[model samples]
Target chain A: MLSYLINGISLGSVYAIIALGYTMVYGIAKMLNFAHGDVIMIGGYMAFCSSSYLGWPPIICVLFSIVVCTVLGIIIEKLAYKPLRAASSLAVLITAIGVSYFLQNAALLIWSSNPKAFPNLINLPSLQIGGTQISAVALITIAACIVIMIVLTLFTNKTKMGKAMRAVSEDKGAAQLMGINVNGTISLTFAIGSGLAAIAGVLLCTAYPTLMPTTGAMPGIKAFTAAVFGGIGSIPGAMIGGILLGIIEIFAKAYISTQLSDAIVFAVLIIVLIVKPTGLLGKKIAEKV
Target chain B: MSSILSVTDLNVHYGSIHALKGITFEVKEGEIVTLIGANGAGKSTTLNTISGLLKPTSGKVELLGESLMGCPAHKIVEKGMALCPEGRRVFSQLSVRENLEMGAYTRPSSEIEDSLSMVYEQFPRLKERSKQTAGTLSGGEQQMLAMGRALMSKPSLMMLDEPSMGLAPILVEQIFDIIKSLNKAGTTILLVEQNAQMALSIANRAYVLETGKIVISGTGEELLCDEAVRKAYLGG
Candidate 1:
């Protein structure tokens, strides 16, 4: 039971990281980059290529994936999303879906459809706590998630650029009036979000040990689900939502059936949405007269 | 004093609607110029166009003798023009201090602390509620926050749109007093207001707009006592 809890937390940490991307993009751009998951897939492939083909060290491979994903994210925003800034939300969402498919097919062409074995990036021995054992990857994933959350919170609260992001998220025209470069801020948001996706991708693949063109699809959907479940645009909400989702999925698999776990997880989301329409932390924006 | 801002025969359209049509005005340094008009008279539209929030279809806007035409809103701000938009559009979720901090985004980090203290001094109420979220502030407090936020940029010319809107009569007086003091301290002000009597009272020069056209222009005292102005806007 203890081992299952640890596993649950580790998995949740990855979802939390990915959900940060989703929540942030939604908050600032007011658009869902459904291609966010595909960015994770691309990050995983980038890491796999660096580690296996170039025989790079693990840290270098991780940094390479982050850089690639960051640049790719900016490119995607510039090429695919920037033009649709004034379009209807429905249009942007469809375009995001198209981008997702485009990234997937592009990966298929470059890396083929075969699943590659993901090398264990963290080789530390498992730690035994009390009567239960926790793998080093699980421990590292949890620690990494905590650090990322702290850093992000500080960045948003303490830094000028981060405050500008929050301002842009609240009111674009007002932010521009304050001399904030709205387009530049949006691009930075995409860069940061996609960079985090790389970290999530590496951690996810390390845990599951498989890399494929379609590897990011399921986890992407789950992380998005976690984002919504936590109250879409709130940062702390994503962490809580992601961790809760991880524990639920693990427990559902352990006590119930593995085949029913995904279904049960989604069912829980539906119930949460019905009970609290804005998720847990989402503030209901009341329009002032 | 030399003109800090000049608008020449500016024309603007909102899709098919001609919102601002050939409007011209000038605001000299250290002057309080008020544009007064009824609702939908293009008062806000003119301000919006001058601030680069809306593009002009024709003519020119120059700040300190440089053409501001085609300059983006953010760039216009860097050139020493700041607009306190209608509706007190403060970042609702952000703290009052954070909202003020955003106002100085174009400034250097070294200047931020000084700017912040200056704004805090101007709006002591904002300083008191500095840690509170802007959404929770009273309407009058929000108005002060918006003014303080604009001041954070240390703008040479401050443009305010409907600053007294939705405020209590007492609060309106306080806001006008602040505007007066700000202008007295050497900031050029371009004010837009529907409160014709109060606006003209403090303005060095005033323009009366009607249906996107400037129908009258004069000294504030002259307009204040003019029979036509009193009959039309001052509730004769």
Candidate 2:
């Protein structure tokens, strides 16, 4: 039972990381970035390529993946999203779906449809805690997520750029009037979100040990589900929702049935939605009269 | 005195609606210029255009003898102009201090603390609630926060749109006092208001806008005593 909880938390942390990207893009840009998951797949491939082809060290590969994903995220924003800033939400939504398909197909063309076995670069030994043998990777994953969450909170609450982001999210016109560059802020948001997605990609591949063009699809959907579960635009809400969703998935698989686990995970979401339409932390926005 | 802001033959369109039709105005250095008009008379549209929120179809806007065409709203603010927009759109989720911090977004990091202290000194009530979220503030307090946030930018020309809207009479009088004091302390102000009587009382010069055209332009005292102005706007 304890092992299940720990494993669930580690898996959930990966989901939490990806969910942050979705929630943040939604918050500032007011557009659901459906292509966010594809960025994760790209990041994983970048890391795999660096390790297998470039013969780079794991730390360097991680850094390389993060940088590549950040630039890719920014490019995606500039090319696919920026032009549609003034367009209808439905148009942007379709465009986001288009971007997702574009990235997935691009990956298939480059890496092919074959799944690559990911090399275990980090060689830390497992540790026994409370009669349960826990992998060092699992421990590191949990610790990294907590640290990242703290850093993100401080960045948003303390830094000028972060405050400008919040201001832009609240009121774009008012933010521009206050001398904040809205386009720049939105770009930074995508960069940060994609960078985190890169980290999540590496962590997820370490645990699962496989890489493919479609690797991020299932996790991406789950992370998005977590974001919605926690209330879409709230950062802390994403964290909570991701972890909770992970635990529920793990328990449902272990206790109920593996085949029915996905169904059970979604059932919780339906219940939460039925109980509170806005998720847990979402505040209803009153339209200005 | 030289003109600080000049708008000549400005025309704007919201889709097919002609919001501002060839309106012209000027604000001399260190003076309070008020544009008083009825609802839908292009008062807010004029301010929005000057602040770079809306682009005019055919017109010229110059600040300190420099053309303002094609300047983004943020760049306009960086050039030392600030607008406290209509309806007190404060960052309700942010704390009062955070809202003020956002106001100084273009300033150097080193100067932020100084500006924050100055803002707190100006609105001590805001200082008392610096940690409180702006959404919980009262209507009058939100107005003060909006003004205080604009002041943090250290703008040479501060444009205000309907600062007294939805406030109690006493609160409105207090807000006007703050506006008067701000102008006295060397801030050029361009005010747009439906409350013509109070706006005229504090303005150095006034322009009466009617259906996207300037119907009357005069010194504040002259406009206050003008018979037509009184019957049309002053509720006499």
Candidate 3:
């Protein structure tokens, strides 16, 4: 039971971190930002390239990966979303899918399809807690996730630029008139969210130790589920949702067949949606232009 | 006073609908100007175009003697024209205080507190509900918050659209009174309203629009007493 709890917490922490990026972007841009998951994959590859291939230090590799992934996010925004700002949401959605496919295929070409290992990063010593073996890396992932979430929450609620994002999310025109550079705010949002995803990617690589082109898809879908499971646009909602999802998955794996893990997680989501379509923390909004 | 905002031969379209057709007008500083028209008279479109939400198909919009053509919405804002958009588009999830703080996002970060205090003084109810989410506010309170948020940006000229819309009769009076006071406090205002009587009462001058065309322009009292305006707008 304790082992299951530890594993659940470790996995959920990653989802919580990645889910926040999804939730924050969705809250402000009202776009699903499907490219978010792919950015994580890119981050993993960047780390692999920097640390193992180039013999760089681990911390420097992680930092470099974050910066590289942030730049990729900005470029994606400029190339795909910005030009199509006035286009229909469907157009942007298709564009995002294209971006995802393009990046995955490109990674396949560049990094090869085979899994690459980060042996040093993966060897986190196991610690016994409550008669259960929990590795230091898992605890580290959870702590890092908590710290990032706190920083992001503070930035959004207490800072000037964050106010601009909330304002634009509320009403774009009014925000523009208030002298906020709307485009700049959007770019900043992409940067922050993608940056968080990169950090998650590095941490995820530490736990799983292997990377390939398609690794981000499962985590992406899972984080997205976590985001919607909480509340699509609510920050705290995503956090709680992520942790809940982790616990459920762990329990399902422990108590039932491992094959039913995905099924159980999604079944819970469907039940929640049927009970409250808006998710646990999501507040229903009144209609307006 | 010299023209602070000048629109000449302005034409706007949403896919060839021709919302504003060759419209022309000007606003001077330190004056309360009203633009009154019936529904679909292009009043809101005019304001939207000037605020850079929509680009005029062809024409000129100048602010402070500078051409405002081919500018994005934020650039127009940086030029010191803040819009309190129609329907009071407040940041619903944020507190009233946060909404107002967002208004000064382009200004120095240190200046937000002072701006919030100023807006709070203008609408004490807003100050009272400073911590309340804007979505929970009544329509009147929302309007106050919207206007307050615009003021937070410290724009030299403020454009207000339908400030009296959907408010109770008493709240309508309070909104107009606040508009008058805001103008008195040194914010130049360009108001668009369907309620010509209330608007003219507070306006220094007024323009009458009908289907994208300017039908009349005069001092507020002069237009208020006009027989045609009285029958069509003021309801005799």
TM-score, B chain alone, candidates in order: 0.99, 0.98, 0.98
TM-score of model number 1, chain B: 0.99
Residue pairs clashing, model 1? none
- For residues A95-134, write the lDDT of model 2, one tens digit per residue: 9999999999999999999999987867799999889999
Instruction: Name the runs in model 3 displaced over 4 angstroms.
Output: A122-124, A286-289
**lDDT (CA) per prediction:** 0.94, 0.93, 0.87
Candidate 1: tens digits of C-alpha lDDT, residues A145-216: 999999999999999999999999999999999999999999999999999999999999999998989998
Docking class of 3: medium
DockQ of each: 0.72, 0.65, 0.64
How many clashing residue pairs are found in candidate 1? 0
Q: Give the interface-residue alpha carbon RMSD of model 2.
A: 2.5
Query: What are the chain A TM-scores of the candidates, in order?
Result: 0.98, 0.97, 0.96
Question: Of the true contacts between chains A and B, what fraction does model 2 have?
Answer: 0.80
Task: TM-score each candidate.
Answer: 0.98, 0.97, 0.96
- Per-residue alpha-carbon lDDT of model 3 for A160-185, expressed as tens digits? 88777888777777777777787888
